[model samples]
Target chain A: MNKRRAARRRGLAASDDVMWSLMQAAHAVESQLEEALAQVELSGAKLAALTQLVEAGEPVALGELAARCACVRSNITQLVDRLEADKLVRRVDDAADRRSLRAAITPLGRERQAAGAKKVDEVRRKLGKALGAIDHAALKRALSDLD
Target chain B: MNKRRAARRRGLAASDDVMWSLMQAAHAVESQLEEALAQVELSGAKLAALTQLVEAGEPVALGELAARCACVRSNITQLVDRLEADKLVRRVDDAADRRSLRAAITPLGRERQAAGAKKVDEVRRKLGKALGAIDHAALKRALSDLD
Candidate 1:
């Protein structure tokens, strides 16, 4: 274990330090990712929504999209509206459930998502270089373990 | 090395998967932190600004605050405006540089920062339990090492 981790484990480090470290680290990584996304005219939120639509591989119900995005339905509606305006996504009637509408990725959306994914990977590779393979694996594992 | 990292290292894993994992992890932790901060009527941006002011230990120029927060000066001004409205921070003429204004934390800001810090620690402890001390340390270490 690193000296700092050992100290934390031994209760020698203050709680504030740990919390500050976590926040700083998250913010730093996020900033880098956000900068990269900005080059493609995408914010983190927009990229995340596009990624979700692409992953679904079909039209996703507005409610389902909100749930997956961890946002309110109204917020999803606004987001979808923006995406639709950009021609990156389209709202269509749900064939399986006529009463509902679903958001589907357009070819443009897929293209933008692919571009955004590339940018994200570039940042991750930079992170990997800074963190090394072992630490990178450990971070991913640890984050995945969070509830 | 874990299978995923090994795959990534060998250029075997799809970039989309790696990107998705990173975003998901960051979003999950951020959501938890945001929820905790909400109890104190502070968003993440407000809390970050207040924390920076408190850490400075004296008034900070708007430019410096912008740099520290990784935002533009105008954005910092708006943020400080809200904090000032809330009476958590106050604007003071910079004695060292008469042309500029600086932001200083109020007594209430200190109290709020302390309270917010406490809530952040509580979440960290919960994270520690979920991740275990070792993995938690690794994750923290990895994140710190990122560029």
Candidate 2:
């Protein structure tokens, strides 16, 4: 016996159900966010990238952006390519390290990112209110523990 | 403002974070379980199908098994083919519905499922105890509200 199966047989609670429900809920929310961002031609990953750029207040190295997104370097390359093609971002050679490149959000990207962020903010608020009605403290505690 | 994103921004207890954590945890558990199951030549999905068949105690239709597994019928077909090749499961003609085929877990499949389930149960218990320090009801409630 490893771990989860033991928990299931003991009937402490259906660990599988707990885990599955969590995945399902996350997937549902992610799908909803993707749909919401579609109008702005952004995926959740793209939106998250833009947000990172906004908070940085300056162009960040491609590697740094990828790390923040928790995605692969190749994936970041594709994401940056799409954003750059849309004129929402630009990749410039790093002045300090010529071999390294930095990604900067364009003025247009800033406006678009701001607009999309408002929508994201609204969605988060509703989720908070609903979760607050349940067990807000517990949820917060779990997240804090993970970090 | 879609529902989830707003809640995330508010920094109000985020069901999203809880959900993400749960998923990450589950993936970790699954990877561990698979490491053991690999010795028996079974993947998680195959093991799940075998378990379902054992629980049914009779031939189970492919479509029904697919639904139970939350997978597409085509995926089930491929899985069944692999299982059949391994002689762990077999496809039998449905007497009532010739158009459909019933999948039956062989004696070997049942034994494998039991052993796998036991190991999985064990791992799950440890996981539950580890997470026991956290509030699960709060997590469940927050996840439920998302629906």
Name the candidate that leads on lDDT.
Answer: 1
> Model 2 chain B: which ten-residue window has the lowest total lDDT?
B5-14
Candidate 1 lDDT, tens digit per residue, A1-147?
443432232221234343445545655677888899889987777877888888778889999888776678998899999999989999999877887899999999989988987887788777667765654555566656653
Predicted candidate 1 versus true structure: per-residue lDDT over B1-147, tens digit per residue: 343432232221244243334544555677898899889888778887887777678888989888877678999999999999999999999877788999999999889888887777777778667766554555555555553
Candidate maximizing DockQ = 1
Off by over 4 Å in 2: A1-17, A81-87, A95-99, B1-50, B57-62, B73-116, B133-139
Against the reference, the lDDT scores of all candidates come to: 0.71, 0.69
Model 2 is docked with a DockQ of 0.20
lDDT by residue (B16-111, candidate 2, tens digit) is 554344334444565776776776676777787887777667988999888766678999999999999989999999989889999988888888
lDDT of 2 by residue, A29-146 (tens): 6666667778777777777788778877899999988876667889889999999988999999998998899999999988888778776656666666766656555664553343
